[model samples]
Target: MRVTITLLAAIFFTAVSYAQVAHNNLFTVGIGAGLIGGLYDGNYPYSSLKQHGNFGLGAPDKLDGELVVFQGRIYQTQHSGKTFPVDDRQLTPFAMVNFFKADKKIAINSALNKEGLLHLLDSVLTNVNGMYAIHISGKFNYIKTRAFPPVKAHDHTPLAAMLPLQHFFEFNNVQGDLIGYRLPSFMDNTNISGYHFHFLAAQKDAGGHIIDVKAENITIEIDVLDSYTVHVPPSRDFEQFDFKKNRAEDIKSVERGDKKQ
Candidate 1:
């Protein structure tokens, strides 16, 4: 009958729509700009994140600390530079994840500082506008990292206000992993552009958001993720937060880690 044919057509179209949406390589809960505005209240649990990807990074709810996912385990590096295993019940306000499938792997033994390393990796990417996940493992000549203390988000405390409270740590001749992503320029508001990484020492004792680094004799893995899928947080704070203001400079300043180290 005509009605049966119409129902079948509807189902077919719905299936196609889901297929198109699920194709994006990157899956993120909330946007990066929310952090700039202090929207740090979310209920997205680490268990849910584990289901999405094993290699990614983000922050825990209430700006508790730096959240890093390496290999298949999730670790929370606190402000004191101590790492702890994150429970499945623990939640994150913002995070980026992907089912990583490496497109290429490169070996570099030449001495390179953070800037140099970033430049070298940048040169490897032929498409400047493309998004890619980068994994660097091996010895680090020197590395500096920092983590934010747990700041109450319900009170509307801006991230800038919590800047002075961040704790920094430095290590030399250490073994660790740097997990992160390099996104396109157009995703400024949607997410952070350029390279962003979080460090976790091999001992699983110390790590945080990477501020600077110097490395040699390391294997760098690159996974190209061309598209992204964002899941908006359903929290009341997220729904009410004002996102109209431009926070590009704020984001850049924070990312640059310009403070005396």
Candidate 2:
């Protein structure tokens, strides 16, 4: 009877240990997915309207802005502010961005398949827009608008070095024409209408040396003026949506083997 009881206890403990390992693995995978999707959603930039040259007609400086452009399409125009407005006339952009050495392991040993992972990413992307206001908080300064530091081959090891402050633009499920849309105009005009996203990477090398800690923030405000005429509309406020307490915490509880209350 004593031996039988010991064997049963051992089985129970083994099962618990296995469960804990699985939980940790799932947590890691979820965190990775969150980071990737968040970064991807944050990088889009707004095109600034610029006066290339005066049209033959006595029109003021010909102000023009481009809509979404692909990865390498450059929009180099002189603008006063860090944020620019994207014209609705421009085409919706599509591009795939890859972060080097973000993931330490190549093979993801999680239950999430490619389709499942993409779905999870879509959910994350959907929640990000217009949901939270971004405030710059970190070491890197965007005041200078400095270019990203170059990457070296030696910086390939796990956490060898974090990528330099980086930013990119990504647009998904974009709708509406680029030219017909109009933006809000204000008398004071302090508050900018658009989305600005930021990301900071923290990495630790194999030697436990902290390297390549950086932050990248991009602001892409959609320009309403280039697209449509203004019509004064009644004010309607937004409802507060909380995903952290609802979705993130629920996933955490499941991984921790705690029953949902």
Candidate 3:
């Protein structure tokens, strides 16, 4: 009887450990389906992002500006090519956030171009199937980014329709933080399957969705988010939108670059 009790205790402890690790997975505020479905409403407030974790990236309600949270600070960039500090009173329709704890840290030794930098990150990944919240900060030789402006209330304009109105920014030989997420390929149906990154200059005055980057002597920190959580807004447009139709092409175009309508 003593031996049986010991075995049971060991098993119970092991199961609890596993559950705690799994609970560390990523927490999402809303589904990307809302974006693909054209449900742009400011339902989730900026305070919600604060609750999920300290480091993450997201857009404001009505796609007003680009948002990046680092070290518990929220940064916003408007379409006027201006960046500023953000407040919790702001609302968000969609955002991804996590309590950032580094699972691994790697020092990039050589100067890597955009493609090479991406390859380096992929090679060091501890789990190909795990969701990762990534941060890269250091001297960047050059970086290109763009921010989306806010739309009027009840406009109901699809994101694709707002592409032409996006404002682009370019920085050379600057230091900043690259806030990003790496989702599994299986998530392509609801989110951008690969890497999605946002940028904020060290000065906290300029940054946006990362387009291209070049740098060296960088430090990359990655946090393995093993759990997934999503909150849906109670907006009517989101409720009535038909996500059954395929919008992968539209999503890809807006996320990357637009070639066709």
Candidate 4:
């Protein structure tokens, strides 16, 4: 009997442990953005703006339309530390594109293995008349910092170092809008939120070099999908309605009878 009881207890503990582990892995989707700031020297034209949207994770693969669209814009200015300015007379025209993958591993591995993708990104930058960089690999967290030119004459090492803590930035005369969100129901329990990615683009010189490098203000957004479990608040113990009266109702009846008497 003692041995049987011990075995049953062990089974119960194992089941409870398994349940806790399962509960901790519930998937969630997160969204965020990054902003850039700076002043334009007379030699260049500059305008500040904000980026926003939802980022995806999991089996069905959610959509981060805003990030996908504005990534290049952010990457060029922030990651490369290059200045993107409009012509003195012309407005700074903006363009955006969206990229998607069925899963994070596939996205990272494909970027690593496929030369075409890299070339495609390069082509996009070449046409932009600005500085830009793209790096997709190893669950989106891996940033190829070496791919772009250094932030001109600026000490951005502090911002770069803080990236692991979250995205960081530096510049003068900066301000803008930034926001983010996470929806758990989108991804079907595949633990997809750990990955990260961004593409940045900004105005540059005829030689595709950034000029008068400076960031005014920056807006940053980050979306983490499948990063961890979400806890559902426990249900409340609401009182049930009864058709039949109990003691409280009975007391009311007695009071009515006393009034009638």
Candidate 5:
């Protein structure tokens, strides 16, 4: 009886371990470097991207506007701070997505800025080397965001050159949700190393890339990813493009809207 019980226990433990490892996965199309280097052509359509995951962020074809996938519905936030539903036929040049299932929840009782918020998350982070999907929703005392305007289709101009033309906005006491990821440093070329968040304002009508924020009395949901896969486009342009150049500074400027150093 003791031997039989031991065998059954081993089987149960093995099953649980396998399930935990396969529970979370991250799917991404195109690399962050491609977005900054002007490989802005559409690689995947919204219809196909939906199959990978339901919650994430990216840019529409031609880098027209900021793309946010929330609750299985896709939205585009234009320079006007107005959000609109995206067509299934619309394509994306760069996107990161995952079927989000919260692994834990943390509630805050004090106001915190972007840096402070990171510190709070880091304090309880399960693994600093693992990727985490974060969802923070509620009223924000203050938040600032930015969005890029549409450019000509297949325009070869690097995204950095357009930062001066990007529009910025600030909101006070805004009700919204922030969808983003906290990636490990090893993922530098594949995605933003730290945090890359997009905001959805109250009623889901306004949003863009979150530049800054202050929050209090809100819940933060975190999902630790177990695996991540990158799908590099199979295009002649991508084939000949150089991925070796250290464009880290340029990429940061594109993401933060900072002037090129």
Candidate 6:
């Protein structure tokens, strides 16, 4: 009788542990091959909006528009500075999402620039090496954002070649949210290691990948990730691309948006 009771208890504990682990995993569609290879076509299978979290970020298939998953609804902002609801069935080449339940919240009192703010966030993390899902909501003194249009069908353009084609926008005294991730340095090969963020204006008329930001009196919420999953593309190009070479310079250029439109 005692053996039977212990067996049941062991089974119960194992089931609970598995459930907890499943809840903490972050879901991703596609790898960072696009960053190195510039093969921007979205090849990953389309995942349902219902499967992901209330807040997420991704660009569309073939690198069409910037996607912001706000309040459980997916919105796509194009280079024309227009925002539209994305169909749930739409696919993405790269995306990271989780059920954004904030584990901590911090309020910014001073007007810190983007670099300063990122430093502050880094200081607050208990484990600097751990992954975090970051969401900031409030008023921004000014923000610079950009979105890319889909590449020409006949063009073999890579991301570095497409930066000059992106549309840039600047907003002053705007209210909205920035959604993204902070990954460890070791994860650089698989993702944007430091901080990657996208902006969506509260008015829903403007949004895109964040180039720069200045804000005060904002609430920054963070979800310390316990798990991460990456889905690779099925394309042969991605499989054969040379990720061994360091493309940090190229990525830095894209992030800076140094090319004048």
Best by lDDT: 5
- Model 5: worst 10 consecutive residues (lDDT sum): 17-26
lDDT of 4 by residue, 1-261 (tens): 999999999999999986554322322221110001110111111121221111221100111111222322322332333324222242111111112111212121232212443343344333322211122322221222111222332222322232232223232222221111222223212211111233233222111111112222232222222224332212121112121322232222221212122
lDDT of 3 by residue, 143-256 (tens): 989887777776667777778888888999899889999888777656666788999998888899987889777899988877777777787777777878776777777777
Greater lDDT among 1 and 4 belongs to 1
Give a tens-digit lDDT track for model 1, residues 226-255: 678788988788888888888777677667
lDDT of 6 by residue, 1-261 (tens): 999999999999999986666456677776554643566666553346437556778777777768888777788899888988777677777777787878899988789899888888878876868989899999999999988888643233657677778899899999999998887877776776778898988888789999999988899999888888777778776777777777666666676776433
What ordering of candidates by TM-score runs from best to worst?
Answer: 5, 1, 3, 6, 4, 2
Clashes of 3: 4
RMSD of each candidate relative to the true structure: 4.0, 25.0, 4.1, 25.1, 4.4, 3.1
lDDT of 5 by residue, 1-261 (tens): 999999999999999886565447788899888788888888799998888888999988887669998898889998877789898997898899888889899788789887898788888775879899998988799988899888886676878888888889898998889999999989997787888899998688888998888987778999889798888887777887788988788877876778847
**Of the pair 3 and 6, which is ahead by TM-score?**
3
Please, what is the whole-model Cα lDDT of each candidate in the order they appear? 0.84, 0.21, 0.79, 0.24, 0.85, 0.78
Backbone clash pairs for candidate 6 read none
TM-score quality measure for candidate 3:
0.88
Model 4, global lDDT: 0.24
TM-score attained by model 5:
0.89
lDDT score, candidate 6: 0.78
Instruction: Give the TM-score comparing model 2 with the true structure, all chains together.
Output: 0.16
Backbone clashes for every candidate come to 0, 12, 4, 33, 0, 0
Ranking by lDDT: 5, 1, 3, 6, 4, 2
Query: What's the lDDT for residue 228 in model 4?
Result: 42
